[model samples]
Target: MLRLLINIFFLSLVQGSVAGSEPYFSLADYDAASDREYIGAVGILSRPDLGLVITITVQSGGALLLGDPPVDKIPSTAVKRAVCGQVISFPNLPERNLVCR
Candidate 1:
């Protein structure tokens, strides 16, 4: 019972650390030649769901500054990474045929 309590305490601390960290979003494109994902755009948002409530557009092929309006918010449901040519679906959004450079 003591060991179990210790394990739970450790897990809580780890979760707290993760929750305290800032969240950011990035866009990646698939490189066909190398068959790898390359980060194209990165942005830090005030909240994950801020994009859902506001118009936040990220133009590809460029890096966003920390305070840029475009990077101020991101979709809460955005994935960390996705494979090219794969179908992606999100809540309240229709499925899309994802194709990246």
Candidate 2:
């Protein structure tokens, strides 16, 4: 019974961490977008303990880059180790379903 209780406690911690690790952001549709208009919906940056949020920006002509500051256009292979996810939303347009992956 003691072992079962310990297992349950560890399982809860794992479940909580997984659920909290999801990265969310509302990227701008245009380069001219202001900081106020661009929203990191999850506000992950402030929580450094969560690790760096790898932002893959989808640009015109279907280009992807690290969207975060000192934004660079590089191969995704370089950032394979970073924990990342995408939050797709039309913040400037009509409301639609939010997609996270």
Candidate 3:
């Protein structure tokens, strides 16, 4: 019974990994698209100890760059962070199913 369970667990892990590795983006549509047009993206904001992630595309500027690309220091040209804490003072980010454009 123990060996059976172990095999099942490993099988499930392999299945999950394969699914995640599949391309989620559609190349045909992306190629046809005239522009990326700020569809929406996920970004991580870092504080002293923790980080917050959100999906948003409706900022003053259309293009929203996800986490500062894990920089050693925040770049001067970097856009403001969304906020990474229990109490977020930033504006409300649109939830899933809501289109950013």
Candidate 4:
């Protein structure tokens, strides 16, 4: 049937062009190294029951800047990059400097 309709239109155009084409985070770059940016931040990773919304996004150079829904609204729920760096800004976790656990 026409090569299965051209292989389902090339697998739906390669799955809709890689579905949103991953790769987002970019807080200018890196941040946490061992907490101190405010006595809070040591490789972010928190889940007092999904208390904090924003998920993951951490480079490894310095500075760190880029807010307002930039780093693709950070969200790595599976818990890989392992983050919870002494943060405080969920309901009242405030004391921020770094976040992404």
Which candidate leads the pack in TM-score? 2
Q: Write the per-residue lDDT of candidate 2 for residues 15-57, one digit (tens) a residue.
A: 1222222232223243434333333222222114543333234
What lDDT score belongs to each candidate, Candidate 1 first? Answer: 0.29, 0.31, 0.27, 0.32
Q: Which ten contiguous residues of candidate 2 have the minimum total lDDT?
A: 13-22
- Sorted by lDDT, highest first, which candidate order results? 4, 2, 1, 3
lDDT: worst 10-residue window of model 1: 13-22
- Given candidate 2, what's the lDDT at residue 7? 30
lDDT of 3 by residue, 1-101 (tens): 54345334323322122222222221122322442332334432223342223222322223232222322112121122223112211234322222111
Consecutive 10-residue window with the lowest summed lDDT within model 4? 63-72
User: Would you list the rank order by TM-score, best first?
Assistant: 2, 1, 4, 3
Best model per lDDT: 4
| Ranking 1 against 4 by lDDT, winner | 4
Task: Select the stronger candidate by lDDT from 2 and 4.
Answer: 4
- List ranges where model 1 is wrong by over 4 Å: 1-82
User: What TM-score would candidate 3 get against the native?
Assistant: 0.17
lDDT of 4 by residue, 6-76 (tens): 33432332212231333322222234564324222223324456443333233343322122221323333
Query: What are the RMSDs of all candidates, in order?
Result: 14.6, 13.9, 16.4, 14.7
Task: Please give each candidate's TM-score.
Answer: 0.22, 0.26, 0.17, 0.20
